[model samples]
Target: MKVALTGAEGFLGWHTRVLLRALGWPDPVLIGRADLADAAVLADRLRGVDRVLHLAGVNRGEPAEVAAGNVAVAEALARGLRRCAQPPKTLVYANTVQAGNGTAYGDSKAAAAAILAGAAAGCHLVDHRLPHLYGEHGRPFYNSVTATFCRVLADGGEPELRDDRELRLVHVTDAAAALLDAPPAGPWDAAMPALRIGVHALADRLAGFAATYRGGDLPPLTDRHDVRLFNTYRSHLFPAGYPIPLVRRADHRGELVEAVRSHGAGQAFCSATRPGVTRGEHFHLAKVERFVVLRGRAEIRLRRVGGRGLVRFPVDGAEPVVVDMPTMWAHDITNTGDGDLLTLFWTNDLFDPARPDTYPEPVAAA
Candidate 1:
């Protein structure tokens, strides 16, 4: 579908564009804030556009300015659409869940939704009210408390929580999907799926992740939400605070280091392999596994089933690295060091002989 999207550079806008592209939608005409002020420019951009996703608004400014800016932007877009030779069939307004509240931001959103509803008389208008959103690289302090906490913790600073209010946070990717999948022509709030947690609880969870990840251990990802949150937290640590060195304890007896620790982990094992020996020639369908070399150099090889080439990663005990095996990839590890190899393995669930997901296949065809 030919689409025109406003605020295409913003957080939600970026995610929405990604989703649209993934779904095979054509490149959307990006409308900037400046374009909204010029009816001629906007109308030209809207020409032949099948859908318009209105995602721009002033989130931070004087109360009166914030209120007026939102209403004005919507009015401008409507005026542009009126001038279109063939106006868009659908107009999606990205409103907030606070639209019903009496605050300036809420009132502004409500007014904008009303303006779009009246202007696009025949076209489908979706006044989607999104809740709190958090994801990778959200502006710290301005966009979300989650982002602020992630920034502070990543920088080795403490995030002070002044209020312990409850928050329902939807990941940006999920929010974008909801917008793309939204039904047409109703002044209805999209039931945005969110992960509800108290402010303090959320802060604590992120802090725990920061600690574990900084200590060179993969934190337990209990579910999809945990995985998303973990990724978001790590995004803030880029270009710095990365390649986190593990805490190594050495003695005359030998050295020891913890690789992975999780309250939710169901199984843990260690293996010893002689030089030139190889282990693992299989892939799992549902199981999650991580391999950490502890006492030798090795090369881990992986290839998707039916794929031609292998992806090789060389790991060494001197500097431990964890490689998480992905599902559907046939993989194996070989000891490349002169001495015997010691490796640690972990999985989220205990192995069941009856339902083991392992299927043996050479990473490289012999």
Candidate 2:
């Protein structure tokens, strides 16, 4: 069957394309759009499409800007669907982790979801609300903790951890697999409603894989990532009602104790700016990491040679669980909170700058 994908060249979009192909689906019609809100342009490219995978939006930045981006995209898509003489079989929107919160990004995504939940029957719609996304096709800066930490530690610098924050994660490949295997139409099913994985354990497991990954001079991105990238300090480890866990420098220790203490002989650390801050814009050939949102909110973005995409996680400032970053992706952390976000930082093993294994990339021409 044929499918139409918006954000075809993006991280998640591109991965989804591969998964579709693996599932025996034909070449899906790729509907590439720079902005999601532009219905006229989107609709023009959407013709003759069987399904639409909406995976475009600003991961982090000003609240107004994020809300505008998300709301406009969904509204425009809905409007476009109405204009279709024969709507596509279904629509699967790649939603962010911050969908239920009051944050601009979260609220906006939630609003967009409402539209998808009630889309016209002829044009079926389903919201693929995903957690932290990491895989081989990710950017160096924001793919996952595995990717991020490997780079941070690869340079042999002690990572500055967030202390507290809880989050979730998932692998791009697994996410892609899930997407392609998803049932068509709206009203997500429990079997395939939406999947959430833990990035911490995922990272540790991959770290085990890395111990044996002695490939070329570059790094090795692997499959499998958790939704909660790290152990978020939940409740903003500080005195702020931002929902993030209140935290301190020592809280970092506690974060690791909970996330990776069981790994034995290995350690985990975190490195990402508070909400509103941008961190990654590169990639790795054989690295891995796990991101944990301890407090506030943030967006993790990834871009690679072939594609890119952004994902939002509304923390309201709290503790993180963990998310894994793989080598095949580039990464960066963007904090999205009004208060100082408390992020739990950890790593899989002792850093090795001498054997530094990672790569880099850029966001746009402009």
lDDT per model vs. reference: 0.78, 0.52
lDDT (Cα, tens digit) per residue for candidate 2, span 219-258:
2222212211221111011112112222333564464324
Model 2 poorest 10 in a row by lDDT: 231-240
Off by over 4 Å in 1: 182-191, 246-366
> What TM-score should be assigned to candidate 2?
0.52
Residue by residue across 1-366, what tens digits does model 1's lDDT show? Answer: 788888888878876765554444677899987788888888888888888889999888899999999899899998888777778899988899999599899999999999999765567898788889987668998989999999999889989988688999887766776676634221111355578899999999999988877665667778756766776786687535533455678999988777776645557899999999999998654356778888899999987544477778888999986676755467899999999999999876777775565666778964
Report backbone clashes per prediction.
0, 120
**CA error at residue 274 for candidate 2, angstroms:** 57
Candidate 2, lDDT over the whole model: 0.52
TM-score of each: 0.70, 0.52
